[model samples]
Structures are given as structure tokens and as C-alpha cells.
Target: MRPAVFFDRDGVLNEDDGYAFEPSKIRWIKGAPEAVRAVNQSGYLAFVVTNQSGIARGFYGEHQVHALHEWMAAQLADVGARIDEFAYCPHHPEGTVTEYRQTCSCRKPQPGMINELSKRHSVDIHRSIMIGDKQSDLEAASAAGVTGHMFRGPDLKEFVAPLLKQLPRIR
Candidate 1:
């Protein structure tokens, strides 16, 4: 099974602006590409898991989200980094949009996203890690049985290098 490096889209990969959707609005954080590339070079699948409550609030549609992802991918590719997959939870328990206002397992703190990926991709949960700026991300990682890294600044390398060293070498 392959090890994975799961990142939270809003804060870890790009600048967090509440519920982001527009490609033009996306901003890459410092060390973002380098961190992603490191994971790739380490033979880890870099996946993005995001909580987009804006969709639930009727701020954007799925098409917009997909477009944003395509744009993000292009941007990452430019830096010699690529995201393997992107997963998101668009539902909001108290969403104003009726269709989106439902409690779902895919939401963070539930581990549904990681669980789905683990099953479908044959990922080793113990060898994976989740990086994000929110506590929810850590909670989800813990629930999924993966190491969690909380990101508070722009430099991800500083946060990740030591942790990466601690993990058993893959090669």
C-alpha cells in the first residue's frame, strides 16, 4: 500500500478565504509547492481534502469547485508538483441551501474522506499524514489513524521536515 500526504486545500495548499471557489482567487502559500513536491519525491500520494461549506451556503456550484481544482492543479504542475486527488465535503449541517443542509460522514472530524480514500486507493493509514491549519483536520487524521500536522504559518517545510525524519524511511 502507498503512503499518502493529505493536505487541507484552503489553508495548507492555498490561502484560506472562508469558502474559496474561484481560480483567480486562489493564492499559493509559501512552501506549499515545495512541501507537496517533497511528498511526491518521497513516493507519497499527495491528496487534497477540503471542507467547502460555501457550496452548502449557495455561494458556488460544483462546476465552480471543479474549475478551481483544475486551476489549482495547473498551478501546482507549474511548480513540478501534482496533487493526486481532491476530496471535499460540500454539505453544511446548518446550511441555508436545503439540498446541502445535511449531516454527512464526509465532513471533517468524521474521517469519511480518509476512510473512502484508504479503501479505494489501498493506502496505509499508519504511514499517512494530514496537514492543515485547523483542529478539525487533526481530528480527522487521528480518527483515520494517521499522523496529523497542524500548520500555522506559510512555511510548511519547517513543520514537516522534522516529522518526516521521524517516520520510517520509505526507500
Candidate 2:
């Protein structure tokens, strides 16, 4: 089983440009690519887990979100950091869009996505890590039985290096 660096896309990978659904508006957080590459080099898979309630709110569609994610993946590939998987929750309990309005476990703070990924990828939940800029990220990791890191402030790249060096050396 492989360990993974589960990331939250909006604040950790890119600036939260409020319901960012377009590639043209994507803004990579400084050092985000390098941080992802670090995870790759450490032999850990990199995955993205996000919540896009905007779709449920009728601001966009699932296809649009996927397109932006595809562009994000392309950008990461350019930096030699490939995402092993990407998961998102498009449901909102009170969503404006009828089709997307529903309770879902895949949303952050529920661990649904992580649990599914754990089964599919055979991931070492304890050794795995989750990085995000929100409390839900931390809660999800905890619920999934993995360590979590909260990215604070503007530049997170500066912090990744030191943290990477300190990750309990895996045998």
C-alpha cells in the first residue's frame, strides 16, 4: 500500500478565486508545485480532495469544474508533479440546483473521499498526510486516521521543505 499526500485544491494548491471554474482564472499558490514534487520524490502519491459547492449553487457545472481540474493537472505535470487522483464533492444540502442538492458523505469533514481512495489505492492511512488551509481538511484527515497539516498565511512553499525533512522516515 502506498502513502499519499492528500491536498485541498482551493487554498493549498491555488488561490481561492471564489468558485474558480475556469483555467484562465487559475492561480497556483507559490511553491505548490514544488511541495507536490516533494511528495512525489518521497515516494508518496499526491491526491486532491476538494469541495465545490458552487456547482450545487448553480454557478457552474461538473464538467466546468473538471475542465479546470484538468488544466490544473496539466500545469502540475509541467512541473513534474503529477496528481495520482482528484476527488471533489459537488453536493450541497441546500443547493440551488435540484440535481446537486443532497446530503453526501464525500464532502470534507466526512472522510468519504479518503475512505473510498483508501480502499481503491490500498493506502497506508496512518502514514498518509493531508494538507489544506481549512479546518475541514484537518477534520477529514483525523476522521480518515491520517496526519494533517494546515497551511497558514500566503506562502506555503517555505514551510513544505522543512516539514518534508521531518516526516518520520519511512522504511
Could you say which candidate leads in TM-score?
1
**TM-scores of all models?**
0.95, 0.95
Residue-by-residue lDDT tens digits, candidate 1, 103-162: 999999889998898888999888899998999999999999988989998687677777
Note the residue pairs that clash in candidate 2.
none
Among all windows of ten consecutive residues in candidate 1, which has the lowest summed lDDT?
162-171
Off by over 4 Å in 1: none
Q: How many backbone clashes does candidate 1 have?
A: 0
What is the per-residue lDDT of model 2 for residues 112-150, given as tens digits with 9 covering 90 to 100?
988898889999897888888999999999999988999
The alpha-carbon deviation from the true structure for residue 85 of candidate 2, after best TM-score superposition, in angstroms, is 0.6
Q: Which stretches of candidate 2 lie over 4 Å from their true place?
A: 169-171
lDDT of 2: 0.87
Candidate 2 — worst ten consecutive residues by lDDT sum? 162-171
